[model samples]
Target: MSEQAPLVSVIVPNYNYAASLELCLRALQAQTYAPIELLVVDDHSTDDSVAVARRLGVRVVQTERNMGVAGARNLGVAHAGGEILVFVDSDVAAYPDAVEVAVAMLAADPRLGAVSSIHDPEPLIRDSLVEDYRALQYYYWTASSEGSISFLFPALVAMPRRVYDEIGPFNTQLRETEEVDYGHRLTQRYDMVLTSAVRSRHDHDDRLGKLLRKLYRRGRARVPLYAQRRRFACGFETSSRAGGSLAALAALAALPVAAPLGPAGAMLPAAALAVSIIADLGMYRFVLRRRGPLFLLYFGVVHFVVNVTIAAGVAAGVVRWLFSARFRRLYEPDLHVRPSAAGEAAT
Candidate 1:
């Protein structure tokens, strides 16, 4: 007889995303991996998400109250029967081979605690300018050299049961940047890989406003995240990106102030801004080469908006963190660990 494959539990935590939930479920059902259990944990979604899960014949675990994504995922882990846990967002549709590839990679390397698929935006990028920018950004970020990765989005990630148990659960208090926190914890013990071999389609918000809001929320969450993991403060994930954006915005803001001084003063800030844009373009040269000059028109505006909004959001988060004792308490790393009883139950 052949050795049995390990059971893989695919957990999807959803809110009011009924429209996209159906497609996400369908993709899970179509996964090539066998002995898979699909579980959808609903966080008191005020939509037809629960009904949709039930109609699809997948087990639905409804939280009594809104526990957010992190809490819902913890609840799912408690109820899971599989030895491997696969977390997929409601807006992501895994390719047929995604689970199989992730599982295979994890199986081949015992040290690999988790593996996240390359999120391809080709499927969702229609004629929308927002979509176009997102697609380009995704391409640039994920096209890095393969090996241990610093970040892993929960949108499509798989990990062994042991890894999750050891690392503990996601920080429920964090409505954003939870994945980064989790990834940081995982890297301390085991390795995480990002491979193009495994693919998934992420349905990003095509609306510019929605995208900016998302970035702002992510930026705000960074305050607490950075507070907990100080080593990551100057790391590529946070400081580099934020610093570059801030620099660009500062130069732009100085342009107006400098204009009143003299033409020479104005030229100084203008030169700085010009240098920043050129550096950004050079950094994303791969994108420019692939998408042609037309991409530059959209990228320039999108880059400015994203950086400016994120910087503002970070500022807001810092003020909130300073004023609210509750926020300060929540930023403590210990608050993120799974409780003893909950961890025991999950095991």
Candidate 2:
């Protein structure tokens, strides 16, 4: 927030997150950055999210239909008048200096197209064990991949309007993997950074089923993009990480098949499991150091299940890619991708 500060519009894309909307906005209200513009773009939420945004004295832009997060964000951008744009999800409570730090990073480096904040290893509100596990897992994944990256975490990220225009709006079709698509497009010419300099606390999935389903869909949805560019958005999504999931999945799939072969076959799955564990042994040790043995044990069990689910999702995506032309063409428009104009998906 230097003198002659440019306007920073913080666009919050919301969908039925009223439970945490107030916290999100209140934190924005207290940002250390000046000349800040905050708007909550509600994507046809059935909950009282709009009311909460209004009560907080923030502008609420309601979408004509359920346009998903990408659409909502595009609409928010359309209404934004700031030189700098910040996208903070409704479920994230950004710290006071989040905007200031992001703006500084962008200003300090002309090559920096986007600066994404890393969330704390805790939720905005303590809800369930699943939430805690997710927060910790996501934090470690991001924290371990700090500095220049190809990934763009939109939950708490900022970029100049010109850079956004150059990269273009997020793909409306990529509701689940828009960030992935955007990151690939952005990284082609500019640098994107993931830093603790701009921090936020996110309200991660509270239910085990919800967490698993989200990851599964994200894993599946990202196949077309990866198939096209084969890009690893960040160091976090490395081959070793994929190997972990695949190894875990191999163990699961081989268990029953190997049961018929008895003792010798059992060794196959055991070795796969060991390889999977070894793949992310650093993550396990990180959790162990922070949460101690008991929580680390629980974290490992949950993470194993998560890895299996992600691998299964990717497997399903591969099968669909081989069979369905449409699935293969999911990111076919990567060369010239843009979001619909502020309101609806292109028809």
Candidate 3:
């Protein structure tokens, strides 16, 4: 961080996750990069999250009500004074070089709008089943072996002030996928980079219900984006055409197991079930290496349950978005076509 330029502001949004919040703030305070204003938005937490944040001496904004992550992040962005705005989750611990790399990367390229750190997939495996599902999803979204990408998880991403000017703040209505959608808009105008020099530790949820709920919300968020025919960011799981179908098929195949199935009739559905399960397992291994044999077995069961839940939610969201006229129009805001040649979708 150069002394001549404006300072950087790191915004962290927290709910009831007090333990995670403490870890996150501690990591921020210990950053090698110093020109940062740390602001923690307490979204009307019922727990001691506010007290914890206050104890840490970071600027705390207490919301009157519980706004989701997007809302909280927008609030933080509004209060940010830095030339660069970095958004971090309360549950993540930023690597020491987190701020340094982010600032340096963005400063290097005038064309760059945003830069994100590499998140190792260790914390996501603490709870084998749930963590594995979430880890797989996270890896699918953020992992890249090559150069910079346009969109990524906003968990530990940094963007220039110009990004907010050209694009805009996150959509408050979208509790999930707001980062993905916002990143897409930024990428349209400026380059989005992924720096190997930066990193963060993301904590994973071990609970089944929480994982299922998250997947459900993600499914709902994707409705409008996909309906508008937006080019997707992440891989197979995030895409509507591929991951969406997998989710739907997984549910349909499960119906036979719940009810009765004749031996011959059962084979096809049984085979489909096996294939889907195996495919997900393979994806888990390939994208996120199995921690161990025991961890893999437990994670496999959890992954199976999580995917079925996600598939069902995605199917419902897609149907609702496609059928509702208002939703379709809202999502697919019409483009003002210019008189230019080859009037395909505008950049």
Query: Highest TM-score, which number?
Result: 2
Candidate 1 per-residue lDDT, tens place, 1-347, comes to: 12599999999989998978999999999998988999998877899998898999988887777887888888888889899999998988899989988998899999999998777747443648787787667655565434567676688899999999999988887778778778888888988887778888877778889989998888877776676556562123545566667767677678778978897787777776665565465546766676777787677778777877877788888898889778767667777785323221211
Instruction: Tell me the number of clashing residue pairs for each predicted model.
Output: 0, 0, 1
Across 175-205, the per-residue lDDT of candidate 3 in tens digits comes to 6776666766777788887655778878888
Model 3 clashing residue pairs (backbone): 247-311
Q: What is the lDDT of residue 292 in candidate 1?
A: 71
Write one digit per residue (lDDT tens) for candidate 2, span 74-193: 888888999999999999999999999899889999999999999999888989988889999999889999988887889999999999888888888787888888887899889999
Q: Residue 12 in model 3: shift from native, Å?
A: 1.0
Give the C-alpha lDDT of model 1.
0.78
**Candidate 1 — number of clashing residue pairs?**
0
**Model 3 clashes, total count:** 1
Model 1 residue 327 lDDT score:
71
Candidate with better lDDT, 1 vs 2: 2
User: How far off is model 3, as Cα RMSD?
Assistant: 7.2
Off-target runs (Cα >4 Å) in candidate 2 are 334-336, 341-347
